[model samples]
Target: MALVELGRFNRNEAHILIGRLDSEGVVAIPFDGEASIGDGSYLFIAVRVLVDEDDLATAKAIVESAA
Candidate 1:
């Protein structure tokens, strides 16, 4: 299945959201989470949260409700 972006957030927030999604049975991952580490600006870089394309709608609902 193709991976699609759910949203972009800082590393911590992305991981939090991943955990939330996981609890709801949706598999998610962070993209570009380490790119900013090299420049010491990780907090300012936006990490993308990705999910399976088929799970996009459900993931969106879970994230939105949690917000």
Candidate 2:
């Protein structure tokens, strides 16, 4: 399954969305979260939320509704 981007968000927000997706049975992950750390400018960097291509639509809806 190819991973596709759902959206970009701050680390905390990405984690929250991951939890939301988890609760909804969608497997989502945040990329660049660790890379954003150690610079103290982590907030300036956006972490990407990725999900399986097949789950893209459902994950998008869940994210949109939470917005």
Candidate 3:
């Protein structure tokens, strides 16, 4: 994979969208999930989707639509 930046997603958001992307047959590689969104200690999940350059638009659209 070229390691394209699919998007920046927090824990709750990633947890919600990963399922939808899976259903859409979009390959996803979770980059990290150790950072907290707010001042709290709770961890967050940041994922990267391995999509074709041409499919970046569609992938972004899918993530946005789910949000």
Ranking the candidates on lDDT from highest down gives 1, 2, 3
- The candidate with the higher lDDT, 1 or 3, is 1
lDDT of each: 0.92, 0.91, 0.65
Off by over 4 Å in 3: 35-54
Q: Model 2 misses residue 24 by how many Å?
A: 0.4
lDDT of 1 by residue, 1-67 (tens): 8999999997888999999999989999899888878889878889999999999999999988988
Q: What tens digits encode model 3's per-residue C-alpha lDDT throughout 37-60?
A: 476654534544455565677779
Where does model 2 exceed 4 Å of error? Answer: none
Ranking by TM-score, best first? 1, 2, 3
Superior by lDDT: candidate 2 or candidate 3? 2
Best by TM-score: 1
Error of 3 at 19 (Å): 1.4
Q: For each candidate in turn, give its C-alpha RMSD to the true structure in angstroms.
A: 0.8, 1.1, 3.9
Native-referenced Cα lDDT, model 3: 0.65
Error of 2 at 65 (Å): 1.3
